[model samples]
Target: MKKSPRRTFIRDTAIAATGFFIVPRHTLGRGFVAPSDKLNIAGIGVGGKAEVNLPFAWNNGSDNIAALCDVDDRMAVKARARWPKAPYYKDYRVLLEKEQKNIDAVIITTPDHMHAVQALAAMQLGKHVYLEKPLTHDIYEARTLTKAAEKYRVVTQMGNQGSSGDDTRLVETWIQSGVIGEVKKVHVWTNRPTWPQGVPVPKGSFNVPAELDWDLWLGTAPQRDYNPAFLPAIWRGWSDYGTGSLGDMGCHFIDVPYRALKLGYPVSVECNVGSVYTGFFQEAIYYESYPPSSITYIQFPARGEMPPVEMIWYDGGMKPPRPAELQPEEQMGELDGGIIFEGSTGKLMAGLFGRKPTLLPLSKMASATLPKSAFEFVENGSDGHQQQWVKACKKGYGAYTSSSFDKSG
Candidate 1:
């Protein structure tokens, strides 16, 4: 069969223009199917969580994996196998430079520190972006990326899947319905650091693996020996490359309440962290590493009629006191952790990703009769988060996505 003229133009014009293919409306004549309008997507850091994220974009049925970039060849093995036709690059800079016109969007699942630079570069070139969550490593980067998205007028979505889930909407409904009246306190906890933390930085330098680029792995972080602890996975525990447990999972657990309560920035924050043993009568303070455990208290000012909200975050095998209403045999949250909202009238709780929410005493949950709120649901549910971005991309900027940079950042 002869190729659709539109498809040929999309490919040829993309390269000829030098960057960002301008789709001509006149050429999209009759019989040119909508589903055939594939968005060429390039992936930066196509491994680890990207193992799942890249697939999410592919399953959306609107993406062509045009390019893949990763510093570690060993890490990129699975992704390389999945899209063997897509050219691979050891440095994202080279990939973006060489394939600028070939891709319409970019998916960034790199380490927290590298997200902003990679994303900013892609957005500057007019490519839509799907960034992994927490939005960025620091507040400044988050703010910058948020503004860039607006200035560039490109569709953007943070990879917080729960933001697109029914749980946030359900909680939003219950809060709006006053089932959990005037929530003043929220407790969110997680069991992370499943990697080593609160320890001295490894002293000896290890040989960099042949398959990995040591300098690229360190990207924005300061120079350091190529320790195994920093490679492949354990980087989450380091302050230089990772954001601790809070940075790693904060977007996932905190997103629901943040969306449900229509929250704003915190007014103040205070924290207490568990200690690491180092010497006799001395607790270790590895400023380079995240604490073994911590309790962070952040207070948000009241919004209009809403009461002031005190949100506490706990991580590293620590959790808030179990709710008095919960039975002794019942688990406070699942093995990983959970969230609890304490309100004037009652309490509501849910596990990670805002799953299995329940009202206190079980009876309150059973007795409460409520209609589903008008909040729109993602067509395929939580898993459709990536697909949501895909739709918004095809529809252009300002398209509805649950966790756009304006909301998530």
Candidate 2:
């Protein structure tokens, strides 16, 4: 059979649109080339959480890591072992300057303070970015990144993996189904184990790691002496380097109820802590890092068709009061992190990102039926949330929730 020129043109157009190309078996074999095809990814911070997430991006099929950047040479060496072909750099700007054209997107898993600067630089160069959550160190940075992402029209995904979970959608469906009719209030809590919480500042000077480029690591943050306790995961407890427990887990823990209730921006935010201590460390540490503990209350106004919602955010050692409806056997196990949606009819409680949710008031749970208009839970079936972003990057599909631009600001 002979193919018409028009058919050949249409096929090629489809291939191009999909960022894929089919080559003859004899030439390049029988495989389709992805659009945004053959992405060369780079890692901005290759320690802590980035180590876990970077691999997922590679496993997603559309990306291949091309560069790794970290202020610590030890961490960079660890990353290099994973992708020996990818070059390493102490400063991300150097990597961006040298490999900007070679890289398709940059995964920024750096500290919250650095997220805005690094992400803005990447997006300015027309590269897509995947930023870790709580988006930025401050509200201003969050808004700035959102605007930059929009201006560049780049694909962006925030590191809130729970947003892409099947359970999350189920909770959304449950809410929309009126299983918990007209959610009026929500109490979200997490007992984030302390890594550096409540620990007073080191009174003595310490030796800095020779492998660490301390200046680069500090970046826009105020300069400080090296302290072993402040590095690695402990940084989350500090205000300068991190966002405390709420900033650390709030995005993930609170995301479900926020999304389920279609929460708009909070009208006001106030913090009530046990005590305030004055020192160089207090300025460096977030309120959640202190002992005796604290709680932040965020109130959001009802907008459009939604009712006003009161959200009580608890963390740095707090737990929700056990619901009265649960039997001894039905009591939730180890309330590490979860949300309870209190509605007029019944209550819906679920773990972070909607994992293993159970309706309260067992009678209501038994009597209530799935809504007729409810959408079937369709698993996207990609490896995970990061993979979903890579797939979206290749296919030009809009970002899923946990999206960088949409969720960050």
lDDT to native, each model? 0.81, 0.72
Alpha carbon deviation, residue 406, candidate 1 (Å): 1.0
**Candidate 1 off by > 4 Å:** 1-36, 60-62
Error of 1 at 339 (Å): 1.0
Question: Tell me, what's the RMSD of every candidate?
Answer: 7.2, 11.0
Candidate 1 per-residue lDDT over residues 1-409, each given as its tens digit: 2222333433432343344323322234211214447877899999888888888888744477889999899889999999999999987767877887678789998888788878887887777889997688899889988988887778899998888888778877787678878999999998886998898888886788899988777766676778887766788788888899888888989887887787899999999999977678887799999999999999999888888999999998889998899888878977888999999988999887788888887667767886586598887768889888887887777788888999888
Stretch of 10 with least lDDT, candidate 2: 23-32
Candidate 2 Cα lDDT to native: 0.72
TM of each candidate vs. truth: 0.90, 0.84
Candidate 1 residue pairs in clash (backbone atoms < 3 Å): none
**CA lDDT of 246 in candidate 2?**
81
Model 1 whole-model lDDT (C-alpha atoms)? 0.81
